[model samples]
Target: MTEIETIESFERHLRSGASLRGVVLQGLDLRGYTRELASVVLAGSVFLGCQLEQESVQAALAQGAMVFPPFLGLPYLPYRSGLYSTEELYAGFDPSRPESYADTLDARIYAHWSAQGRAHPVSIVEALAQRLHDHAITDAMEELLAGGGKHRKVVAIMGGHSMLRGQPDYRGVAVLARELTRHGFFMASGGGPGAMEATHVGAWFARRGEAELDAALAILARAPSYKDREWLSRAFEVRAAFPLSAEDRPACASLGIPTFHYGHEPPNAFATHVAKYFANSVREEGLITIAKAGIVYSPGSAGTIQEIFQDACQNHYNTVGVVSPMIFLGREFWTRTRPIYPLLEQLAQGQEYARFLRITDSLEEIVQALEEYDRFHTLSTIPR
Candidate 1:
């Protein structure tokens, strides 16, 4: 430890431009420092068990920086890219390798967090690169506004990660996804295996839903679950059935978007843009949250049901502001079998909800309902 004794020593060390590996600030009274200085001083560094004096704490609090644990952006992120394996992600993580350059990009990333005891800033270039990888989304928006493409409406199809590509429900979701995309609404999903990948694959081959889709499903049927090795390639082979080119694509041009946090399953190559994250919880939350535009809870198992109410809670409180359409696709499944929409209605009648929740059987009606909601609703950005 280079003895940084007083404020002067700190100043001298900073001026020297020596790369400070880590900071051991445990119980050093930083309370007298100005809040602005506190933030500026630690903008690009790490703090480990440091005693932030009351004044410093107050400044951090005033500036909206987390004082106790230190503010890191979005605690639930893909901290390490490839550290956790398929089963580990699906279940839990193994012991992290010792701090070294050899593990993986994400392992190193998490190691930084594990050692530092606080959230650290990544290089701005890295941040911008992430932004650019997802430029398809922003471009799509501009394209819609410019009249090249018509819909900016993003409808997420949420369902079980275990649903196979060949089943009836899988085809149902694919047909629903393609139909919705044909109408101009962009389709998004969790970007993982099973139903999420199917949703994207549907969108990828939006225009042509002939025997090709059925063939893809048949191939995937060989491996129903995400754990199967052949599962991902089956979907890709299905995509290979129909050649998608830059000039020649879906007639209406909708996007199939899958993610890779469940990297073991592999992201659907068909998704025009993939806004994947390293954290499953974050990815799951963002997938549901961003679907504030609209959501179609297709026939799914537990995870689907969880997302149903999670979306409802957001809508119930009008969490995103405007009440976007909540269209449950399967009538029999939603009404009688799974019974989510009725539950929502029962919850909303006497209780208060955003008032734009609509459950129906007709695909056209679902799309129209979304349009209607978008028409009258002026979104409020009230802080929660």
Candidate 2:
């Protein structure tokens, strides 16, 4: 009754004349295996995306095997370990034609999913599939982080997706991300537009110098915002201009864990690796939790504020093991305009969270703060 965890194990059992009682066969192609199908016992087993003949399906059903069909035209899977590629999502799209976005794989998938609704309650099939897909993404993310191992520290930039591409703040964040990734820290963000795009774009250009980044930004400035007509097209233009040769790709990767909850804002291409998901709550909390080094908060709206307090709660309760730095990157915005920084500082006065919070206008200060944390503080060891 031992469970079969992989195709190799299933094949080995079949070859050895072993019983498949209580074995779970996930994602295995079971087509044209009449002999194996006839021999094996599939009681209490589950098969996902397994190809089988009609007789085999009936046999498996008779033996109590739960069979799930292969996903149709979905660009992602529940068991994949990496991010979606632009090529996969934009399959038939002509990069030269911005209007082709409407016909892309990503667009089609969004349309289908949106039609089903994204509220707390959804159809059992869609909800179950999405949950399973998200769980797989979490598993894949752990594998990714472990691939970096002890030498790599995860850090992230938090800010509004509304920040335009041509603005000073966007350029500044991009520069900061480029510098950080160059210095062995991995950069991550929400993976949408605005400041998030800037983070990935910076990491994309990490191997290059400031002038190249400026040049790239100038190219992006043509589009400015994601809502602009040429946003995706202009981004591809910059990507082409500063192409990353195979040898030039950074050893430290940048990630974008975007969610379909905000599918209207497309996930940027700059994030070399994207852990896109369906549940936004999981995406948000996990993004903050995984950045063991710390997070840099730029000026944002309600979403940013919510992240601040959510992060503060984690810091206050020491929720994730170590209390990494919480840096506010906009002095005037957070202090004079929002005043959230002062409030946070006031709240943290006698609390353990006080030591981790800092507000500054200088990007140099932000970089230095992270450097100090890496030098002195223990990295967060909390499990995902």
Candidate 3:
């Protein structure tokens, strides 16, 4: 396949004339732009999840272009090259009446996908298309982050999204995330609830004092879990009550890479931005890959365990140019119930990779580990 070019405007294509080939029209409105649109070359091109008039569709078909209608299970066009906004996902929702969520775009999208008999999709073709869209979104996300001079400084917090709102662990996650953000790290997470929400919450309140974080947590504590009746509403409530000013908030510092494959868990509202994807595997791998600074592992279940090994593999193989720190936040849980930490220690013994590993319950120790990594791998130029 030729390199694919995304075209969202008809006028842009018109400028290129008959040279249009290997183009992917992304939900662009081409109706009545020109009757001669059919005369242009379209071989090896695709009309990705676009809306078209009968004439345009027939013309594109005759000219050997592939037409794929908007994904029936998703509200927004799947081919668009951008991350989702809360406003876009909650389009029909009213802040004044936060209790009713059935009619919101986010809820509708979730419902549509859920009705398909899966939480995340498992089909081959669907997975391929979703992966393509995810790769584009990742590219766009990297460009946005790189533009802000925080390319490889991104850090991640790994934990189950099921952590309840008012719990001590959740508070610790939030505080740790806030401190990390204050230290100039671009905090990242799986983008779901629990510890992931806390990560974004910390980054969201990076410029504020501990008192403000306490206040926000107090408000969020009203609805402890995403399963609660007012979980989403309470988050909106806190956001509205303690709104971040434009001057104080650096918008793109934190990121959430959540997958719709786990659509049951909504993406946390606190993430400065989100790169939502349809493939969970891609989302999981990408989340680990971008956290060049290091990853902090909090208490979690199977998914978190999988991340531990995956991140270990990356460090063990010296992937991404250098090994990054891996800090375990819960000593008891990781050492006893899980016991994967000892195994990891055994594997790293007598190897240079051992320096990159740390297991501790102390948040301070976690911070020290990351700082040590930076000190040892000091860079002359800013990392990209």
**Per-candidate TM vs. native?**
0.57, 0.85, 0.82
Against the reference, the lDDT scores of all candidates come to 0.56, 0.81, 0.77
Task: Write candidate 1's Cα lDDT for 134-181 as tens digits.
Answer: 342333333433344443667888877777766777877777777777
Lowest lDDT sum, 10 consecutive residues, model 2, at 73-82
State model 2's lDDT.
0.81
Q: Residue-wise lDDT of candidate 3 within 194-275, one digit each (tens)?
A: 9999888888887778888899999899989888877888888878877778776674257888876787777778776778
Q: What value of lDDT does candidate 3 attain over all alpha carbons?
A: 0.77
Q: Which candidate leads the pack in lDDT? A: 2
TM-score, cand. 3 vs. native: 0.82
* Of 2 and 3, the candidate ranking higher by TM-score: 2
lDDT order, best first, reads 2, 3, 1
lDDT-better candidate, 1 vs 2:
2
